[model samples]
Structures are given as structure tokens and as C-alpha cells.
Target: MVSSTSEPTVVRVSQKGQATIPKGLREKFGIETPGEVFVYEDEGRIVVEPVPSPDELHGIHAEGHERGEATERLRELRDEEKRREAKRAERLRPSEDE
Candidate 1:
């Protein structure tokens, strides 16, 4: 049940308990023929949210840095972690002479 300023549009549930989302609400929420939506209950009210595509989520974390810079930083961190693990393993290994 969606609330709006205008008169509330009543939707009839089919025999299978499926109700069609009103056209106006569908357009406002970007619900296409095959689009995905997240439906959950919030405070006893059902909430429907459109799921954005992966492309739409790209560069969402680019507020403080460029994508390439962030990727490079991640790579550097991974390399540093690998180096630390190798040093720890070497310290734990028995001497070859022993």
C-alpha cells in the first residue's frame, strides 16, 4: 500500500496474492518490466526499493580519490600484507643447517 498526496490508488490482489504496482508509482520508482526491487517490512510497513545495477554503483566511493588511485592503494596494501606474511613464515622456519 503506497501513500501519495493524491487519492490513494487501490490495487486488487489476484488469486495468487500478487498485486500489480500502480503505473505512476512504478514509473516514479524506476520499475521496469524486468527490474529488481527489494521488498522488506519496516516498522510494520512494507517498503519497496529499486535495486540499482552494478554500473550504477560504479565510482560511488570516488568522493576523496580517483578510481585508479584507490585501486593502486588497494594493490599496495595487498602487496605489503604478502610481504609481512612471508617475513613471518621465514622467522618461523627452522634453519636449513639444523
Candidate 2:
């Protein structure tokens, strides 16, 4: 498995394809009530990640950055992450010369 936490957890999916996240897992991931979680598939595996709501992220920049500035900063951070991921993939992929 790509990642492991204790043992595998079996969650029941309803007819609507909705599955409940285990409380322990939710708490460990900082999932909060009335919040949202990022769901996606990666490397043939399903991933569910906790994402801070806009309300939660408000005023995150303790250095007194304004709301608009903070939003731009968050966008910059996301773009930075994407660039880092691209670099990692480039390094891992086989070179054409190979």
C-alpha cells in the first residue's frame, strides 16, 4: 500500500455513493463539522484529504495580511505546490535518452 495507518478501515457506502469518514480518521485529519473534504484519485487509489474552509483559513496570515492579500498568498502557495509536484515528476520519469 502507498500509505498505511494502523489497519485498513472498511466503510459502508450508501446507494448514493456517500461514505462516512470514521471519527478517528476525521479528527486525525482535522476534518471539522460543517466543513468540506477534498476527494480525488491518485495512482489508482482513492484519497480523501481534509481541507480548511474559507472561514477557517480567514486571518491565517498572522502577520496582518489583508483578506485579498491572504487570498493571493494562498493562490501562490498552491501554485508553488504544483511546481514542486511537477519537478518531482520530471525527476522520477524516465528520460527520453534512456
Candidate 3:
């Protein structure tokens, strides 16, 4: 993989001390919204990480759990369990099968 570097970009902080990360960096880091987390190095090379709020965590979980219907949920869970059991049985089977 090619190592890509970003051009120097200036970000201005408002009186409220809020700064917008550059669009290029945002796209590069997959940061689309306010709740996303990020880590960056400062001039001293100190790593700083932004923590997401409880609401953000809850929202992400909610979006993941929204599979439309309960039947779909059960079906997916059952399918996953079946795959797990098959893998376990395969592992437990004799090496002669190979």
C-alpha cells in the first residue's frame, strides 16, 4: 500500500473553541459526523483522542440493531449459531478427513 500524506491545512477555532477538521482529512479518516472518534498527534507528538458522548454510542448501537423485523433478527442469529456449530464440529472431526 502507498503511504499518502496530507497537505498542510489550517483550521480556525471559533470563540466557542470548536474547530472543524479539514474535509480531506475527514474523508481519509472516515469521520462523517460529530460523534466519531479520532486520535491525532500535536506539535510535541502527544497523542490526543476525542471521546464520543453516551448519546453517540447509543445511537450507533440503535442503528446496528435496527434490522427491520424480529423475524429477521432470529433468522440471522440462528444462521450464525449454525455456522458456529459447523465450525466446531469440523475442528473436532478426525484428521483422516483431511
Ranking by lDDT: 2, 1, 3
Q: Which one is best on TM-score?
A: 2
Clashing pairs in 3: none
List where candidate 3 sits over 4 angstroms from the true fold: 1-5, 39-98
lDDT string, candidate 1, 1-98, tens digits: 65552335678989998788777777865678677776666456565655655565567576875666645754565456457546865876899999
Q: What is the lDDT of residue 92 in candidate 3?
A: 67
Clashes of 1: 0
Which wins on TM-score, candidate 1 or candidate 2?
A: 2
Candidate 3, 6-83: lDDT as tens digits: 334467989997787766555554555765554454344423233434543454445556555444643465456457
TM-score of each: 0.49, 0.51, 0.36
Q: Among all windows of ten consecutive residues in candidate 3, which has the lowest summed lDDT? A: 43-52
Write down the worst ten-residue block by lDDT for model 1: 1-10
Q: Cα lDDT of all candidates, in order?
A: 0.64, 0.68, 0.53
lDDT of 1 at 28: 65
